[model samples]
Target chain A: MAFENYVNSNESYTSNQFYEKLLREIPDLIFQFKIEKDNTYSMPFVSNSAMEIYGFEKDFLEHDAGPVITDRILKEDVKAFLKSVLKSRDTLTRWNHEYRVLLPKKGVRWLKGSAKPEAMKDGSVVFYGRITDITANKEQELRLVLSEKRFEFALEASMGGVWDWNLVDNTVFYSEQSMKILDLDETEGINSFENCISKVHPDDQKEYLSDIDLHLKGITDVYENLHRVKGRKGTYKWILDRGKVIERDKSGKPLRIIGTHTDISSQKEREDELKKTLDIVSEQNSRLLNFAHIVSHNLRSHAGNFTMLLDLVDDIQDSSEREETLQHLRTISNDLTQTIEHLNELVSIHTEIKIARENLNLYEFFQRTLNVLSEKINKHDVKIISLIPDDIHINYNPAYLESILLNFTTNAIKYSNPERRLEITYQLTYEKGKKVLTISDNGLGIDLEKYKDSLFGMYKTFHQHPDSRGIGLFITKNQVEAMGGKIEVKSKVGEGTAFKIYFNEKV
Target chain B: MKKFNDVFVVDDDKVYHFILKNLLKKNNIEVNSRFFENGHDAIEGLKENSKNGTTLPDLILLDINMPVMDGWQFLEEFRKIKGTLNKETVIYMVSSSNSPFDLNKAKDFPNEIQDYFLKPVCLEDICRIFLN
Candidate 1:
């Protein structure tokens, strides 16, 4: 017996009515879709829920709802809906699809449909299916995908890598990009908090740890630090690291922290370059100020002398007296020319871009200087002692070395003590992997305490000697500095003086 | 009676000494003029004259930028011992420097330094110091 006939024989059970009531009560829109041999598509059976889902009347759908159903499906989804139905009919397979449909009362809504297809002996196919509203679920999925894409772009644009630290577990987790930044191999597994900290440069580790500690203790709103980290190929890169405590315990202690590391080495290099250029510019400014002072003071002294001599000539009535004053004027004019020449030499030295240099024997230069001052050395009965090795060589300008040697030697002879026999000693020593030449004399030493500040200043004389023009030491100091060297002096009153010249070998 | 009996000219430049002496002689301000090349010698001469009971110069023409001891150093030393001397001396600072740094520094020693004169000081400047 057929199951419907068997239930009908009892006359009390209404099987068709029971199933129709069940379909009406459910939330889904249940239906049977069909395709005939002539390739015509139709929805032969649809439940009453179509009224709620698509705003259609149940009576109208029960009659011939195929056109209304197709029309209500959005224009963009109609093609895919038809294509899926045809595919299921031809293959006699289960049909599954999600699509959008438009309605009169409501706007566009998402629907999901799933059904099983069966082929009939009359060359027709049928699909029994159900479709529920899936609009809310789809929108949530799209929003998630958009947020993930934005995060990916931010990391790629900044050359940043993410790091997560679980404070409770003391474990560190680095994202794939972080591994690339730290240049760690994939097999290097399970980084501990200590292991991650070891990658920070020793000089920067202190501040980096202190910053995180501050954030953990709630002393800071966010942990931010700029420090160096050991990077690829054993080099260091400056990193702008920032993080925040996302989770905290009841005691307000941090449980988890996440941060980003951005490579900022290039920015740090530019800052250092700016600082160095500023230093050089300020140094040049001070030097220019000093040069201006020299020009003003020296020239004014000569001009003032000329004016005084002219006044004297005007006041004298005698011709011989006037002629004598005129002779003083001539000498003053000569002195003015010499002062101008000295100023010109200083300007040239200051403007020199490249100084010529050669490898010269230091002992030979000293010997030549001694020979040139042989007459004065004998006249003063000064003992010239040379403790310098014959093979000692220096890279320097020839004229500068000769001039420096002669100036020191002559100054020693000139300032020799008259009461005591004077002895001048020259020696070469190596200090800090560089050559230092020392010249010592038992002459009248300067009072370094009183004149140390202006010892190398132009026209600064500390002695009453007739030959003390006070230009030689100033010029010697300029030459020494021009060749990337430095000079220092140690002296005491009534004792002796020693001049030590440090030569830069790398220059 | 002459207002100044003794004068001291402390300067390093020989030409300045010559011109000042000639100008003074020409002006006929008869006084025993003494000269020292530097501040060191000038202070030493002052101390020696004080020890020997000789009269200190009533007028001092001081120059800046001298060797061994500068004008400022001389003033510092002079301030320490000026009260011990029998006579009071007036000091006039003379220098070729027109730097405001030097001029402002001169203002710091008002009691020790009476005036600051730019160099090539004329006979009129000398007359003002002596005749005033």
Candidate 2:
């Protein structure tokens, strides 16, 4: 009977040894803990894999697990680990934690630990849990958070907008700066793709949609365009939308897109205005070239005629006929002199007034001009009223300003009505940092509809006056423009005329 | 100066031609001088002379400004009329354009233009051209 009992008992002991061998062969880091009185902890079992995870012998933990907690757990995480364990002790459920743990040979590692409660018939709790080293994954997540913060700061400081799109969900992700660029509040309702399209200018809506579609179809890797968007102030702003399709799946379907928006309204406006100014200047230059040709041909012809006439007088022998020829020649010579003088004056005006710029006192300049033309003003029975301020000033060529003022005042007097008493008034007004001077006259006003186009052209005389050479206004216009100023005229047939001059105010 | 059978004055202004013709006569140039209102008529007269085998103008006073064709255009067309008269004919371009551009252009035409004279071509200028 003793021999039979020894064989059965030995077989049972062999089966138990096989069970323990099977548990040790598993790859996971397994452990068993036993709860004691006074909230102390003990490990009844620990797998050999604990050596690989904690860099310690499994026997050390199994011998005295309470000391292992303090030795292995980092100094900073020890308190929290104890508190978590104590809080979950009464729950009779699994408790888990992620904390930094120090190893005997390894420096430090990120570890996850858990424990489950087991109830015995004696009301004592026992637990089992596993520990994992997740140091690489934790480092990767930390680096990603830092890079995102840097990108957000850069975008906000540059006043740029960043956006991302999820192709699978058909949803868009916008940074805080992206909302600001759209002139929307941070708390405003989320914008759908259709809402973004509606804000684009009507002329650009089709192009905007088509570009996105092309990008989505994987036909293009990038899309960029300039479009007008309504701002918070309800005014249109020009923005450059540039984006790249970053990801595509195996079947060539777009997965994600990233882009930025930059405000370029000021630059676009400057380009447009520059093109317009260039066109105007080109047209004016061509007209001047044509005028120069006509001037050369006409002037030379008259001079040639005069010279030939004088030569004929010298060839005549009879004294009586010679004297008569000389008399006619004198008349032609006088006309030629006047024409040449007019031409010389026009040329001088173009060259001389182009070089000089100085600060000018309007009050003094106007007074001097009036003094020079006092005779004509009196002869025309004109009442001159000056409304210039003493402190007003402008940057201009002194001689040009004098010439312009003289011509305007003289013209007002010359074109005055014979039966009516002429009243010429000068008024200066400052608006929005620009100086405006208006010279109004009660005179025989011009029919602007008929002569407006040629009013400031050389040799363009509309009135039937003996002294209307038509050069004064032309020179005035050139002088004004050369000084960075402009002139505008308003008139009616019989009522009156007003000349408004706009000039930059002296700071 | 050698006298010739005829002279031609081509210009638009009647006063210029009248004065030039009388001056030529007073200087005792002793030549039959004719006047044309413009370069077109003057060229026609020259063509008629060439056909008749008569001597062309001993000296042609060419004015630059005229109604139909000017002195420069006439010179271009005159070169095409291949005749014995061309070797003997002398041409003077008279203009009132005091621009150096015009003077430089005149000098560029090597053989067609004989000389350039400014406005008021007086007796002294004419005398100098012939004497030189």
Candidate 3:
């Protein structure tokens, strides 16, 4: 109706001039495209804005616009652009396309062309359309796509995935990477927050729920927890789950939450390894300190004796007395060398060597030790009672086993009471899933209540026996401990002594 | 100054016993001195002396790190029976160990132990101890 009014009430221009003026006033490049009988395109009408949009002179485009227009189209999109135009012409349909173009003035720009095509009686088609400079809109759209892609890439790179939870609806949305980490197929029913929580390991659910509850209640800024998530096969993977309450109601009640799950199983394994190494280092440090104390005390005793003896040798003037004192000096010097050798041996005993173990019969080893000590046993009139079964075997280092047996049995004999007939009993039993060998002696038992702490210490003597050099039990203790065994002694003054050797045997 | 009529040298090491005996005799500081092997033997001697109405030693040289009852155990027992003794014995702890643990431990018995000495006790230490 407006067009009719304007055409009839022409001011100075005619109807064609008025229509042209209208088309040129629009903010688009309006055009009429004709496909002739030979399938060549010609733009019969084009607005003046074509010069500004396409960088073409208006007269040149109206005369022959096909070659210049096609040349300006981006090389990569030329084929597709032409194909779309032809399709629109043949189908007599609207042509709508957005494409890039290389303009003479503007280097490169995004353009949008939309037109409705109509068939004519001459077997040619025409499209009345408009083209607009959509460079800004296209750039904005591309930036949105790029930012989305960057977020996806960041999630993938961190071995983390996003999760959106709606607290009001109790629904959860998991990203593609989240599904993969949970070992879930798309069809699996994990859409509910409850269902997702069920996948948390039973042991970790308490902490996970508490962390989320705290954040939901605004007690914490973020909900974070290191938890194990159950897999499809019932195995678990450690996940560092972090989330924040993103939306809340007016009353400060959480309505929505967003979070990320990072697979931290490998990192957890490394932490465990670091902890174990620290434990081993601390253990070695303590053992080294104990060894230092032993070295200091034992060496000092020897040095002090040598000093006192040298002083006496200077004071003695009689020839026979001087000779005797010198003899004592020589004896003490030899003792000092032996003490140094023992210390060296003690230092070398603390290595982790689980090899060199042999299966040896306990009864037979005891029999051999008894046979070797028969002379001493007879001289002391000792009665030996052994209760070990012949078939009982223990896994131990053979040399250590022999030394342990010899030291303990010889100790029992040497400390036997002279008032009563000396009796030694060897018994074997099991205590707390370990083989325990008990050696009892009805002898001058030690005052264990007074000396329990230092019973097995190196160079510690508990009796005045001439043969009590205080090294046998120390060496025996070291050998037993090296073989992964422990010794416990129970004694009473003047009654008897019982030693329990607990052996660690793998069956 | 109180004269030391009776002195007890209590030690497990035979070498210390020999050295102390010669040092005392060579110095001509004559006293009725007795030697015991360890704390157990010295405690037994003290008990015997008490029972026989004999004099308890005026001075006792105590050695730590002996076989049966160590110096610490002897001091613990001595504290209980000390009130019955006729004289307050001047006790000195002599040890080969110069460890801070042993030295600090001797300081714990301020009333009982007169002093702690690191041994190979010199003639000067002997003279100072006799003076005490």
Number of the predicted model whose TM-score against the real structure is largest: 1
| lDDT score, candidate 2, position A119 | 68
Rate residue B78 of model 3 by lDDT: 90
The true-versus-predicted C-alpha distance at residue A209 of model 3, in Å, is 6.3
lDDT of 1 by residue, B1-132 (tens): 357889888988767877887888788878898999888899999999999998899989998878767888899999988998889899999888776767898988999898988876887787887785
Stretches of model 1 off by over 4 angstroms after superposition: A1-281, A314-331, A358-361, A379-396, A408-453, A459-470, A480-507, B1-4
Interface RMSD, one decimal, each candidate = 3.4, 7.5, 3.3
- Give the range of the ten consecutive residues with the poorest summed lDDT in model 2 chain A: A1-10
Model 2, which residues run further than 4 Å from truth? A1-27, A38-41, A57-66, A90-93, A118-125, A162-176, A184-194, A206-210, A217-219, A246-258, A264-400, A406-433, A437-500, B1-132
Stretches > 4 Å off in candidate 3 = A1-34, A42-68, A103-114, A128-165, A169-224, A227-239, A244-255, A261-274, A317-331, A347-366, A372-398, A404-507, B1-14, B28-93, B98-116, B127-132
Question: lDDT per residue, candidate 1, A1-507, as tens digits?
Answer: 012512545465566566676787898888887777888767777887888887786476547666777898999899999898788877888899889999888789898999999998899887788988888888888888998899999999888989898888888787888777777778643478888788899988999999989999999999999987786588988888899999999988889999898888898999999997786566445544554665576567678878887777767888987787788777778777866766776677678877788999999999999889889988888888899999988888898899788888887887777889999999999998888989999988988887675566643742323245356777777777777778899998788889998887565
Ranked by DockQ from best down, the candidates are 1, 3, 2
lDDT of 2 by residue, A298-414 (tens): 555556556666657665778987886776577557655655665676667556634566888988999998888888877777898989988878777787778778888888887
Least accurate 10 contiguous residues by lDDT in model 1 chain A: A1-10
DockQ of model 3, rounded to 2 decimals: 0.39
Write down the C-alpha DockQ for each prediction. 0.42, 0.15, 0.39
Model 2: lDDT of residue A255: 87
- Residue clash pairs of candidate 2: A312-B19
